[model samples]
Target: MYAPTPESTGSSVDDRPAVERLRHGDRDALTELYQRHGASVYWNAYGVLRSRPDAEEMTADAFLTLWTRRREVQLYGVSVLPWLIVTVKNLSRNRLRANQRRTADSLDAADPPSARASAEELAALDEAMALVREVVDRLPAVDQEIFRLCLVEELTYKEAAAALGLKHGSVRNRLSRMRTRLQSELGPRS
Candidate 1:
């Protein structure tokens, strides 16, 4: 169910006006544009880049490029959405290529984890993970999504809330309840 969710439904109301000004060369258009598209743009970049730091940088770069080339770029009657999508995609690809080049040049793959752990250690880890998954599966669909985003994808508390269209405090409260339920099911592990 989470895999089928729509990331962006459409443009915002304020964005429409700002995009109009941007099309006409208004300098303040940049602010409006940022307000409208910032989150969506960052999410798109994050999907492709996978690194939070890089996704942030790429989103900024994509907007900066639009601002810098405002004169040269003509919106005509086109919606700003496609232009932004194309720009973010290209920038992400370029960043990915640059990263690949750097990694190739360095040839530095880090050392593997220690291999001395006993079979029981591995089993405990796997069992704990399975227990966590079972607890998550027992949650409602929306709560499952929030839990997955926070725990599996490692999104920040706020970021997971935004991605799932929930309030930050709501996310926290749901997570709290989820943890309590999971702990109850896990029982005392002494």
Candidate 2:
């Protein structure tokens, strides 16, 4: 996933007047704004959702609701990015609910690893995790650094940025893309 570059704007990037026009059924303005910020919205959705299809769907749903509620919605501020992020979060929650409805799901129990798991099972799980680490280490050096800083050290993006000499946004975008690539390489779960 590509990170959005800062756009050159004399006024605030998300001017209130621009938002008012969009809220008043200005289709062209809506289209323009969507084009300008779609990538950021997608990345925000991807951060929460961790699925391309889910992120895409959440992005679509967010904009659709923005369009649908145009007249009724109030644009209170200039930071449309925050609004879009909040909207995507809400949509992701909805998507998660729908997904939960389809699957037998729970967050209650913490079953220990199988008590009867043999030495073979422990060895296999260890081998699988080691293989995952090897694959991670084989990635581009920047990816390896980002994974280590975030996962191994549990650094927030800002901290990772300072440690690795990368922008926080770049760290976020790289991690998002890395998760998708890893999921694809791993194939479907049993």
Identify the leading candidate in terms of TM-score: 2
Pull out the clashing pairs in model 2: none
- In order of listing, the candidates' clash counts read 0, 0
Candidate 1 stretches greater than 4 Å from native: 1-9, 12-17, 23-25, 76-78, 108-190
Query: Per-candidate TM vs. native?
Result: 0.47, 0.48
Model 1 agreement with the true structure over 1-190: per-residue lDDT tens digits:
4432222423434355666576677878887677667777888899999999989977876686676556555453434656666677666765676577667755875445664567999899899999888878878866776676576545567765544445899989998998889889998687
Instruction: State the displacement of the C-alpha of residue 72, model 1, in Å, after optimal TM-score superposition.
Output: 2.7
lDDT of 1 at 176: 92
Q: What are the lDDT scores of the predictions, listed in order?
A: 0.69, 0.69
